[model samples]
Target chain A: MSERLAVLKTYKLFIGGTFPRSESGRVYQVTDAKGGWLANAPLASRKDARDAVVAARKAFGGWSGATAYLRGQVLYRVAEMLEGRRGQFTAEVAAGSGLSKAKAAAEVDAAIDRWVWYAGWSDKVAQVAGGANPVAGPYFNLSTPEPTGVVAVLAPRESAFLGLVSVLAPAIVTGNTVVLVASESAPLPALSLAEVLATSDVPGGVVNVLSGRAAELGAPLAAHRDVNAIDLSGADAELARELEVAAADNLKRVLRPRPGTSWTADPGPERMLALLETKTVWHPTGSLGASGSAY
Target chain B: MPSSPPQSASAASPLADVTASDAALRRFLHGLPGVDAVGLEARAAALGTRSIKTTAKAYAIDLAISMIDLTTLEGADTPGKVRALSAKGVTPDPTDRGTPPVAALCVYPDMVAEARAAVAGSGVKVASVATAFPAGRAALPVRLADTRDAVAAGADEIDMVIDRGAFLAGRYLEVYEQIRAVRDVCGTARLKVIFETGELSTYDNIRRVSWLAMLAGADFVKTSTGKVAVNATPANTLLLMEAVRDFRRETGRQVGVKPAGGIRTSKDAVKYLVMVNETLGADWLSARWFRFGASSLLNDLLMQRQKLRTGNYSGPDYVTVD
Candidate 1:
């Protein structure tokens, strides 16, 4: 047992496919249910946030511009990988969220299903929600909803795995870049999920997962003008309100806190649609009145 | 026994007997204390000072407006107008015999048949405002009956207005009961409950009503009846979208949001769309969750689509569908 303990591996932050310690080089210990030290989570800083934003902005164009069908395929790959590692997630979630093994397994299953759900939505959303407009004028008009570029996510605290997946999958599926702040106390599973995303065809920087206190990191992300939206799911009431006000600086889209519920609840279409932008373009129809009409 | 016709008993009430007089309702509404207490001067001043930037996102902007009134299509020429709008995808200028059709055509119990027949095979869906639309002032039985009748008549979706009078009068349980009753009658049909934000009268009320509707099994929580003066605006839409998003987080039941009334142009539609996307994200961008309710909005969107597809900008008259 001592020899096995000696062989325990170290974890690092995943940024743009490369693992690095916090630029701050700070490490914090995360514990299991029995008060035993499980692993060290990177104590991410403002510099890390800036680095993530840079990575996300760099990756935005390629990921968001990818055809919806291709995006869906990449998401499906992530789901497949997650499915392969189901036991790992179940163990980690049980440790992190302090749930029973059976409950943890169910959550892991739901999280994987969530990934597949959003992946399927990538290609079909546009056809279902947008289309050519029938205008009163001779104009080629169309209203298609597009991704709102880079987004910053605050994963829910209680159900770390599913919450993180819920926010990340939707943000990336529609082509927007994401910087996710995993639950501070329960960061291991989030880091592990990142490993799955890394192995999947998900483009680096499309999702940058950081493990740290949401209070320390969330404000900067919410207030960051470059961050188009903030999902304040993990934050407390005070934090949620503060982020809401801070988000107003840029009129950033702020998804307020839903009290008394974890992220494992039924995430219907409403969650996905909340983070999209509809662009309706109008063009002049070049036609003269009755020019070809008979006398 | 089969449930006695829903809302059947409530037909005996004075409110039910009140004639469908738009003018009388307008007058009564105008006479409300708050309606006149806030002067147009103060309102104008308030409006000028507030520069509300539109938040464009996936979830916030998907608005589904419930149109229960078909006055715009009521005439000897209405069927022709409906047919023309359905066939050509354009209408003459309102001042010049052309009023653009809305994102959808919302009709009532009887009119669902006409709207469905007219809009069939067209991309437009035939939405019927059901479960005691506008007032929802009837009994639960009658409201459910109304919903059943509309769905039976082929309403693709049902938009039921909550009992605002009950809600404002502190009858939350009653409001919940009524919405649940209507929801029960919906069966497989989609249910959208109008909050009548103007009647709710404040952001707090709007938020509260939003939650109440979601709690009572509303598929979509909507913002107003265009008949009201204070119609759907960016601020109201923002508040409602936040509620919907929060509700999703809590119940895991993602309720759709619709901002009906006063949305009449492509710009207006885009602004609302931007709000949804920026607030909710990409998950709610589909027509399944989002829609616009305007009598004249779709034509503008169509015209914009045409322009995007073709480099040329065609006049409304020249851009006939057929």
Candidate 2:
């Protein structure tokens, strides 16, 4: 009896809601942990990074302007989509990380729950992070945290699914659009997430995923005048410093990669708050007693 | 193109001799060589692919900035808005004094004096759109009055739209006489004839209008009124560049070409400068012989210029809100 051939999925970079091959038409061989042949992921170039920034900038206005309620629902919907694609992600994760099936399934489950965790914080983060200020003068002063435009993120290499979701969901939940550089080696899961995102309620360009060498893609994104901030969580010691220097050109808000992080641990509101800019408004009412008239 | 009896204007230094009659004008315009559409488009597209970078890019950005006629022609234009725009035109990047001021401040006739006042000592010429502008559908007297109004308000350059209805209908003499009449009223202020190329229909018509406006005494030939779906595309602009280059060759009369609408990026602006340099040579590279009739294009240029200077991307927040 003849054996049936297995259909393999083509991994492409997600930019502006569409999956496109790298502008340079270059692809790299992505392998499993034991050096087994996996798939060739799109080797995104600097131009791809530039295009991603453009898409993120274009999506910024709409996504950032959306009401917190709508943002929360949209993010929650991503969780739902990820939940349905559980089996596929589990297999990919297991293959890429050389993890047992049970452990990979647990990672997928944690990643799905992380989305729900960040989704609920969408409407409440601003309230918890900002409020009416107690000024010394007779005025109504209010401060609110606003998204800091387009954010560039480097998804963690070791913890592909959970770390990618952890960094991405937080930035977007606060109304910031993101251009994410997927992990260098285990990028299959991150690239596959683009499909789930496209199928989900998450608006295209709101979260663009690119799979390539972090060094090749990171420089342009870091130095890009349009990119407002960059989260260097996935970058190594040397690459992180290099990107931080380039990001300084535009004075981008840099979140340096920390030494060690457990993906399963509960992440506080720090990541979301890190990508936000506080806007303070002041309105004068003069001095008022019990009466409506000013004293 | 169909052959015609040699034009009376073709034989002389001055183009004024052709406006003697409508038949003579039509015969001359049709007599000009037909444009090879495929070749023109191919040449324009080929020129657009030139990779301009670094120092060349810096020079192009500055030259393009100096060639822009900073424009604001909305009905909702307030004095405050015009003043703010004029200030931005004068000092494009307030942080960097090295940034050159734009070539001119383009506004409506009513806002010309206001714009002029805002840009007095800055050497930024004030260009006013007259002759019923964008539409050019009014009576001759009203159109003539529109030119008179802008000129009287101290417009350094008067941008007048031709009656496309008359031009397309083959009323060549009528269109020629109207431009000549507006030219007479313009006096010291240079006359820039707007064809609104989107309405002109064909490359043949654009080429013919180019010759017609120049023969009628237009100091510059502008592409559009910025109110149409198609305006100042590279192919159309290249065609204008050729017309101006040939006009200078024929009559020793240099006419500037301004590709006005829909050019919103610095990269697109640089491609145009490359076209001008290649098509008309370095002589027409200055603001006197070339201009960009644009509003949002200034910010893009400024942002790009900042990027070139600092080696980083700039945002809309850094540049003025146009």
Candidate 3:
């Protein structure tokens, strides 16, 4: 056979379901865990973070208003797509975290399972978090969990594949659109996942993956007036504190990860509830008569 | 501050004699210097890139907010919609009362009374789109009646669409006569002539039409009707501004330039403002001489103003739905 040339992959940001280069026209050198030159990832600037927030906010309306059953089905389809590309992710996971092939495959396996776990919770979260309250008056008092609009998520620093899925699935399965800053040192796997998300039933802008510095991307998002909440799981101590202070201006719900948090641990409904708002509705009921007892 | 355009100077201006006949009007309009499309567009693009930051940006935001002609011209418009738009024009941001009121509240002729009442004592003027706007296909008598009815209903300004069919057919005299009639019916209400540049097809035609409107006694030469496939673009706006600038220099009668429609973001508004500052100097910066016939542009300026005030980026949730 004659000598053949190879076509290299171009790493671009997945925003609003399309791969666009950084608006600043800046790209940074990304290296494998061994500190060897790997590829160039788009160095998303403050403007890109601004654009991601806009996209997330635009998608929030349609995604949150969709039926819970539909969201669950869409998220489950993401897992199915991820499974189809498990080999590719395993290689990326190995390069990203310097893990053995077996360990990387295991991480990819757990990530797919994490998606399945979160998908199953989409329709059931409201029941677990909401209930009808007992009131003395003839009124029905009900509390339901609602998505807190656009959320800015900082993916975990390590465990790039599994950790990314663990944080992302919870926010989206609960109907909150996300602008997620991928792992700064190992953003390739997360960027690859964007392809999976696009092909699956996951809607555009539902999960925007920006590969850049967490500090650069997170600051604007936390203080952004339009963002309803922020999850600072991957932020460092200094960065997290700064973001929390900025988030206070808009009264944004903040979800900062506690120390010693493990991505492999059985993630309870805590992450999902953090990105949700409790809306308690009160409806007046007429006195019991021909209609029987009031609800 | 620049003085207003002389109302009775249609006969007194240097170019007044040209509008006396179709042949003369065509000679003057066509004889005018041709536009360099590439150069004009490059200048506009260059001006668009100037970074107006810090205090300068804050001032521009407030200035843009005040210059907006808060318009809602949908076929499904109601009295309630006009009142809400009036409130928004009067005080664009409810959270911050320090925000400046917009220049005008623009609506259909039928909604003028409602808009006038809603913005009654506020400095915000009530502008009505008349003269069979957007198409201008009706007969001259009907179009004039539309203007008279709008003015009678207390419209502070009249936005009329020029007959593109007549203008394109080289019937400048007919188009000029129609505008003069509408201008007479407008009376005290300032008349803004809409060329709908997207349909004008060429820059030279836009320049000629601008001069035609100015000579026919237009208080403002507007860019578009906000209903076309293409509306106020930067290149077309720059061409219009150049026309108004040249007209003022020759006739000593300053005409207002309003780039209406499709200008939705604060960034785009600032670029137009930059063009105005560069092309017409600071004299046309205020609402008296320059205006943006826009609906959503107000909210974006407010969001940017809020962002600058608080040192953080803002979202759509903070701004009202309108």
Taking the candidates in order, what DockQ does each have?
A: 0.01, 0.62, 0.79
TM-score attained by chain A of model 2: 0.96
lDDT values for all models: 0.71, 0.91, 0.91
Chain B only, TM-score of each candidate:
0.70, 0.96, 0.95
Q: Which tens-of-lDDT digit does each residue in B116-233 have in candidate 1? A: 7876764556667766667677887887888888889887678888888887876666776677778887888788888888888665566666766776788887787666888877
- Model 3, C-alpha of B171: deviation from truth (Å): 2.5
Model 3: per-residue Cα lDDT over B1-322, one tens digit each: 1212223336555675787789988888887777788888898899999999988998999999999999999999989989988988998888889999999999999999999999989899999999898899999999999999999999999999999999999999999999999999999999999999999889889989998999999999999999998999999999889889978887888999999999999999999999999999999999999999999998889889888878799778788896
Return the top candidate by TM-score: 2
lDDT of 1: 0.71
Candidate 1, what DockQ?
Answer: 0.01
Name the runs in model 1 displaced over 4 angstroms: A1-5, A284-286, A289-295, B1-322
Look at candidate 1 and tell me the lDDT of residue A85: 99
- Which structure is stronger by DockQ: 1 or 3? 3
Per-residue C-alpha lDDT of model 3 across residues A207-247, encoded as one tens digit per residue: 99999999989988998988988999899888999999999
The list of candidate 3 runs beyond 4 A from truth reads: A1-8, A131-142, A280-295, B1-14, B33-40
Candidate number with the higher DockQ (2 or 3)? 3
lDDT of 2: 0.91
Q: Give the TM-score of candidate 3.
A: 0.91
Candidate 2 to truth, TM: 0.92
Query: Which digits, one per residue and each the tens of the lDDT, describe model 2 over residues B175-294?
Result: 998999999999999999999999989998999999999889999999999999999999999989888987887678899999999999999999999999998999999999999999
